[model samples]
Target: MAESEEELKNLLMKVKEESAKYGLKRNIKKTKIMATGPITSWQIEGDEMEAVRDFTFLGSMITADGDSSHEIKRRLLLGRRAMTCLDSILRSRDVTLPTKVCIVKAMAFPVVMYGSESWTIKKADRRRIYAFELWCWRRLLRIPWTARRSNASILKEISPECSLEGQIVKLRLQYFGHLMRREDSLEKTLMLGKMEGTRRRGRQRTRWLDSVFWVTSMSLTKLREVVEDRGAWRALVHGVTKSRTRLTTIFTIFKEDMSHILSIYLSANAFQHSVVPVQLVTHKQGFRVTLIEQEHEWGGTSACMEEHGLGIWDAHQNAYAVHRNTAWRDRSLTSWMCSCMPTPLVPPASAMCTEDWCGSP
Candidate 1:
C-alpha cells in the first residue's frame, strides 16, 4: 500500500480510473480493509471501507496473525455438529458398530477436516483434534465416560490410521503428490516458491509442510526430488498411513446382539468365528464330524471328531449328540448313517441293511 496521503490518493484514483473503463465501481460499503501495523485513515472518493480484525473466506477463518488455531476450533465445532446430526444412527441399537464408523468416516470426518491439507497444526491444535476424535469414538461406541478402557483397546477395535490426524496427514501428503505432478501451475509455483518479504520481529511462522517430515522423512528439497517417483511416494504414504498403533486384533464384528445367534463361537487369537453349516463327512473309520470347536475364541481350525450319537437338540436348524462310550473305531455302520437322523429312524443294531449309500448320493 502507499504510505503517504498523496500517494494513497493517486493510487486509489488510478484504481477508480481503471474500473471506470469497464463501467465497474468498488462497493465501498461492502469492502473491508485490514492491516497488520498501526491503523491508518484512508478515503476513496469520500467513501471509507470498514476495517476488520478477521474475516472468513470459503470455510476457513482468516486471522490477521495467520494462525490456524481459529480454523481448527471452527472445524471442531462444525465436525461435532455433523456428528450430532447423525446422533440417531450413531446411537441406534439397530445400527452395527461398523456401519456407525463408516458413517463417521464417510460423512462427518470429511466435514470436520475440510481444508486440513493447508493446516499448520500446532501442539495445542493437535491436542484439541485428538481429544475431539477420541470423544467421537467414545460417543459412537457408546462407551461410558466412567469406563477405564485404554486408548489402545479402543484403537484396536477401530484403527488409529483412520483417525482425523491420520486423515489429515494422508490428505496433505496426497495434495503434495498432486502438486508434484502438475505442470507449470500457479499452485505448484507457490508451493515450491520461497517467500520474499520483510521478516516479522520473531521466529518464522510454521509452514504447512513442516509437519510432513514425519511422513516423508525428508526436507522440502529432498521431498521435491523423491516425490517425482510416484511409486516410491505412494509406497511411502501407504507405509505411513498404515496403523502403527493397532491393537492385536481388528474384528469385523464382535459379540453383538447375540439374540439371533445360536451355537456361535469366537477365537480372540484367530480373529474369526464359525459360520453356519458345519460339515458332516462320512469316513471309513465309522464317521467323522467336522465343526468349529466352541472353545477358545482363538480356535484356529475346524475340529474333527469320531461319529458321536445325538445328545440333546432342538427340532429346528440342528440336532446334536455324542456317543459317550463308543470309540470311533468301534462304532457300527448303523450309527454312521443315523448320526444326523433321529434314533427311531436309525433303529437298533445289526438288523439294518447297507444299501450302497454312496450310490444313492
Candidate 2:
C-alpha cells in the first residue's frame, strides 16, 4: 500500500502506535515484503522483516511479478496429492464410476481450482490444466500410462458435461460480472484501472482481462453493457462455457476417429488398387460414416450410401448393407467394407442383425 520505503516506515510506525493503544502488537518476524521489480531490505523497530519473491495469502499464492503460474502448479500438486489420498476409493471395484467422478469433482477439482478465478491463463497454462484433468481421470479409472488410451475415449467413458477449463471460465466470468456490478470497491478499481507507465519492451504478457476478453470474444465496452443485465451476462457465460466444452468434445472425437480410420485404410493391403473416398458427416446425435466408391483403371461400379448410414461389410453375402445406427461394433475388416471390392456392399456389424445378410439366429 506504500509507494516507498519511507512511506512504508511511516505507515508501519502509525500502525504500531494504533495497535499499542488497543493492547496489541504486530509480529515483525512474521511480516514479509515483496516488490514487483526488486527486493529491498527493511527493518522495523530494530527487527529486519523478511523479503520474499512470493508468499501464500488466504490460500492463494501472491508473486512479486503478479503471475499465477506458480499458484497453478501448486494447485496441480495439491490435486495430485488429493488423488493419491483417495487412491483406495478410486481403485475399489465396489465404488461406481459415477461415485468416483463425483468424488473427484468434489474433492480433487476443488483443490486444483481453489483460487483460479484470478488466474491469467495462457495457452501453455491451459494445456497444463487440461493435462492435469486428464491425469486425474486416468488415475480414477486405474488406467496406466502404458494403456495408450486416447483422451477422447476417457472423456466419452466419463461423459462430463463440462471440462475443468470450462468450469474455470464459468468462475472467472461470474467473478468478473460481480466486480463489474459493484458501484465502488478496491477490487473493482484495481481490475478496471491502469497504471501510467512506459513500455517494458519485448512481447507483452497476457493480462487477466485479456484472457477474459479472448474467452468471451467481447470488448470491455460491450462486456460492461452486457454485465449491466445480470440475466444476459449469465446466459453469455453459460453459452461460452457450453460452446467450449462442445468444441473440445467434437475436436477430440474428430482427431481420434479420423486417425483410426486413416490407419485402417492405409494398413489395408487390399485397397492399393482402388481409390476409396471416406467422408465424415457430423450430426447432432453423433457422427455418420460414409464411403464413396470411385471407379478406377480396373473398372468398378460406384456405390454411395444414404446419409447417416454406416457401410458395413457382409462377409456371408459378399455385399454391403447400410446400417442406420452410428454406433461402431468393432474395428475389424469383417465388420467394415473392403475398398478393393469391385461391387461394394455395406452390412450391419451388430450381433442381433435381423437382416438376412447377417444370417438368421
Candidate 3:
C-alpha cells in the first residue's frame, strides 16, 4: 500500500511493533512481496520475504502485471474440477434435463464466477468464458467431442436465460454501481482516484473501469449520474444483459443456418440436370433456407452455374441470376435476382417483375 520501499518498511516496522505489544507475532514465512516494476527483496527480523509473480488471495489470483488472464484460466480449471465431481449426477439418464441444468447453474457457475465482479475482461477472457460455458453444457448433455456439435446448437438446446459472460457483465456493472453510490472508502478511492506517475510508452492495458464503460456504453460522467438512481441503474443493467443474450442467440442461429445453406450449395454433386431454387423461410426461431431438387419442365436450357457459387433462375422472367458479392438484406425474390444478375443476363424492363419469395418484399 505504500508508494516507496522506505515507506513500506516503516509501515511494516510500525505494524510489527504494534502487534508485539498485543502479544501477536507476524508470520514472516507466509508473507510475500510483488511489484509492478522491479522485484525487491525485503527482510523482517532478519528473515527475507519471497518475491513471486502471482499469488492467490481470498480465492482470486493476484498478479503484479494486473492481468486477469491467469485468474480466468485458474477459474476455468476449478470449474472443470467441479464438473468432474458432478459427472455421475449430470450423466445420469434418469435425471431430467431441467434438473441437470439446475444442478449446473447452482454448482458449476458459482465456482467459475466466484471473483468475476472484479475481472477486467478482455476479448480472450470472453472467449475462454464462453468456451467454458459450452464445455459445461456439453458435459451435461454427454456430448462427446467426436459428435461435432456446434456451440450455438448446444446453446439452442440449453436455451439459457443468461450466459456466463453476460453474468460477468451484470456483476461488474452491479459492483461499479455499488461503488459509485458509496461514501468515501478505500475501494472507491482506488477505483476512481488517479495516481501520480507517467504511464509507460506503448498501448495502455484494459482496466476494470474500461470493461464497465464497454458493457454500459456510457462515459464515466454519465455512468455516475445514472448510477445515482438505483432503480434506473438496475433496469439498465438488466436490459443490457438481456438484449446481449437475445442478440447472441439470434446471431448464432443465423450463422448456423447460413453455413448449412452454403454447404448445401457448395457440394460438388449439389445439382445434376435440373436447377433447384432455394427458398428462404423465416420462423419464430430463425431463418431456414431449404434447397430441394425439382424438375424444370419449361426450361429452355439448364445450366448449373457453379462458378458463381449461387445461381438462381426466374421461371416467369426467363432470366438467370448469378449471386456474387450480394448482400443478404435484399429479401425480395425478383429484386434479389435482378439486382444480383449481371447486366447481360438482366431481363428487359417490360419483363421485370417484383415477387415476394421470402414472404416479404
**How large an RMSD does model 3 have?**
13.2
- Estimate TM-scores for all models: 0.59, 0.69, 0.68
Q: lDDT (0-100) at residue 88 of candidate 2?
A: 89
Tens digit per residue, CA lDDT, model 1, 1-361: 5656578668777887899999998677777656675555446677876667678889787877778898999999998898888888987899888878888888888987788888888768877887787788888887888999865567557654345776787888999888887888887887778877888998877777677874455887788887899898887776555422222321121123433323332112111222233323333333332333222122212222122112212122112323223322343424443224333222223312243121111
Ranking by lDDT: 2, 3, 1
> What lDDT does model 1 reach?
0.59
Estimate the overall C-alpha local distance difference test score of candidate 3.
0.65
Error of 3 at 333 (Å): 26
Off by over 4 Å in 2: 246-361
Question: Which portions of model 1 show Cα errors greater than 4 Å?
Answer: 1-26, 40-42, 195-203, 243-361
Error of 2 at 359 (Å): 40
Query: What is the C-alpha lDDT profile of model 3 across 29-94, one tens digit per residue?
Result: 888888776767777668899888898999999998888999999999999999999999987889
- Higher-scoring candidate on TM-score, 1 or 2: 2
What lDDT score belongs to each candidate, Candidate 1 first? 0.59, 0.67, 0.65
| Each candidate structure's count of clashing pairs | 9, 6, 0
